[model samples]
Structures are given as C-alpha cells and as structure tokens.
Target: MLIDTHAHLNAPEFAEDRDEVISRARENGVSTVINIGFNRETIPTCLELAERYEFIYAVIGWHPQDAKDMTDADLEWIAELTRHPKVVGLGEMGLDYYWDTSPKDVQAEVFRKQIRLARELKLPIVIHNRDAHEDVIKILREEKAEEVGGVMHCFSGSWETAKLALEMNFYISFGGPLTFKNAKKPKEVAVQVPLDRLLVETDCPYLTPHPYRGKRNESGYVRLVAEEMANLRGLPYEEMIQITGDNAQRLFRLPARS
Candidate 1:
C-alpha cells in the first residue's frame, strides 16, 4: 500500500465530498494519509477527519502565509493539540517569499515558535518552503532541528538543499511538481534523493499530478507521483511502493511495523 503523507482533506474544497475523496484514496491503495492543518480555524476539522478515519493522521501547525494573523493563544493551543494521540507532526510551516503574504520577520517568528513547539513535543515537522531556500536552511540549522527530524513537503529545492536537509536528518518529499515537464529542480531531486530518505505526497486539493494538472487533486492521485518516481529511478513499481511506503511509515511512525 502507498501513503500520501501530506494532504488537506479538511479544506473547504473538500467540504461537499470529503468522504468520497477519502474512499477513493483507500480504494486506490492509499493505506494512510497525514492531513495537515495550516490555519487557526482548521485544527478541529483536521482532527475531526483523523478521528473519523482509521487511516488518517493529523499534523497541526500554522502556514507561513497565515502567520501574520496568528495570536499567542493560537500558538499555545497548537502546542496543546500536539498532545493528541493521532497528531504526529508540527507543520506545513516554513519560509515562503514567493508571495510574501506575511512579513519576513513575522513569518520567521511564527516559524521559530512552531519549531520550538515541535522540539518540546518531540514530534516530526513537515515544512513548506517556496523561493526562500537560504533563509530556510539557515533557520533550520541555527534552530538545531535535528533533535526531532521531519520531511520537507513538496520539496522544490536543489540536490544541495536536499543533501543539506538529509544531513539535518530530514526526509525529502515530492509531489505533482515532479511530474511537470517544466519542473527541472524537482526532477533532479527525484533522481538524487536516496530511496530511503525520499517520500511521496499528493498535497491533494492543491497539486494534482500531470494529466490532471489543472484539476482539483486528491490522495488517490498519489499513485501518479509514485509511478513517476519509480520510472525516474529505474526501479520496479512494487519496489518503489515498498520503499516509499516504508519510508512514510518510518517517517510518520505509522501504527504498523514495516
């Protein structure tokens, strides 16, 4: 079975048919999914889905774009949510200068706070970075994130950056972008990332793989991403499934022993 380690099943886009989406993912061989919570308002919904679905897990934290709006109480509450049994990670959090939706300092502050929260809880983190490579690496290094390693979700950086993250004891995750014809960087990272440190995600309801590019995404399409990786690495489909599935289970500490 495969796993889409980063998805937003609770997003408003899924409000009308969340059950169908999850069912499709399961029917398509998705054994598990980590539903990431990014806003102050989404934590309850994220956890609710996790509670309802046996294969769903939760990762609670604020997104960098939403950083400017968070309150001290929100951060505190997020820390508290980490106490829940099914919540396994701390973020989809990191630097994003592509849009600069949040001020740099505010984003940095929120990122650091979430890092601290992850450290305190001793849980893995799922990072989202877009066009802010150097600062992201600097912060992860200075913050000493090795204490509790994590994955760089939808990782779009270079082999150098992927190497840096792996050195810091983090996994490299990729999604639909890897299937794009114009995604040179993701393609390079796919070929370079070690099989063990590599992971697959759908980022569903956001980054649908090619052929479904402009359409709304769902966890079931993660198979496309895995197939691309398998073809890129010249490995058999079954081996890719086992390796990537094992990588996800190990990274998220999924219930079953792989």
Candidate 2:
C-alpha cells in the first residue's frame, strides 16, 4: 500500500473529477492520503474530504502566504478541529520568503504560534518552507518543535538543511521535484535521508512529476515519485513504497492495515 503523505485534493484543480482522481489513486496503490487545508477557506473543505472518505485524512493550519489574513479566531478554529477523528496533524505552516505576501515577521509569528499549538496538542506538524530555510529552522528550534516532531513537506533544501531537520527529529519528505532530471539538490537529499526518516508525497495539483511535469498532478502520480526514489536509493520499487508507507503511518500515527 502507498500513502500520499501530503496533498491538496480540495484545491479547485480537481473540482471537476475529484472522485475519479481519488479512484485513480486507489488503482495506483495509494491506500491513504493526508490532505492539507491551509487557510480559512480550505479548512472546512479539507475536513469534508477526509470525512467523506475513510482512507483520506486531514492536516489543518495557516499557509505562510496567507499569514497576514490569519486571526486569533482562525487559530482557535484549527485547535478545535484537532478533535476531529480524521485530523492527523497541524500544518502546511512555516515561512515563505519566495512570495513575501506576508511580512517575514508576521509569517514567523504565525509559524511559531502553530508550532506552539501543535506542541500543546501533541500533534505532529507538516511544514512548508519556501526560500526561508534559515528562519524556518531557527523558529522550529526556538519553539522546541522537536517535542512534536513532524514532516518537512515537499522538502527542496540542501542535504545540510535535511540533516539539520533530521537532527531535530523531523522526517524528510520528497515529492515531484525529486523526479525531475535537473533537480540535483532534491535528488541528492532524497538518496541520503535515512530510510526510517524518509517519506514521499505528490503535493498534487501542484509539483507534478517527470513525464507529467507540466500537467495537473494527482495522488496517483505519487507512485512515480516512489519509483524515482527507489531508483535513486537502488532499492526495489515495492520496497521503497513499503518503506515510505510505513514511515508515513508511523509519523502520522495512522492505523495499521489489517
């Protein structure tokens, strides 16, 4: 079985055929998917998808890009949702210097608040870092995020950064970019992450993989990422799938297959 460790199936890109895309994911061996809702708008929709499908789960938080829009009430809403049976984690949260839509200080404050909340709730966090590696790491460290270790979603940083996150007890997840022929850094880090600390995802409807690089992505495409990871690590494809699936389940505290 495979688990898409991170995805946004609630995104408008799949509105036309979300069910079929989910069906295709099952056919492609994706047994579970962790969908993210990173803003006021998506939180409810994210929960709806998870509640609709037994195998789909949810991760809720504020996106760094939308950091400026988040409010005390919104953070409280996320805290309340943590009680939902299918709500598995507390993020897609972190700093995003690339867009700079929110002031860096604001993004950092929001990121810190979410991390602190995750710690309070004892839930793992799913981080989204975009060109703000140093600050992200610094904040995670200052917040003592290791107390509630999480995944560094769609990680695209250097091996050194990967090592630092690993040191802080976080899993390193690789996505579509690892399959790109020219994505040297991600490919390098993908091969080096300890198998037990490794995870894979599609981050679909975005970051589509190799042959489908320019097309819309779906969870089924995560298999391509697993295949590339297997090739890079010199392991059998099925073995790679098993390893990542197991790691995902363990980190997310997912129930074991019967």
Identify the candidate with maximal TM-score: 2
For all predicted structures, in order, the TM-scores are 0.97, 0.99
Candidate 1 worst ten-residue window by lDDT: 249-258
lDDT of 1 by residue, 1-258 (tens): 798999999998988998899899988888899999888788899999999998899999999999899899999889888888899899989988988689989999999888888888888999989999889988999888988899999998889989999999899999998999999889988998889998999998998999899999999999999999999999997889889999989888888833
| CA lDDT for candidate 1 | 0.91
Pairs that collide in candidate 1 are none
Model 1 CA deviation exceeding 4 Å by range: none
How many clashes in each structure?
0, 0
Q: How many times do residue backbones clash in model 1?
A: 0
Model number with the top lDDT: 2
Q: Give the TM-score of candidate 1.
A: 0.97
lDDT of each structure?
0.91, 0.95
How far off is residue 15 in model 1, in Å? 1.6
Number of clashes found in candidate 2: 0
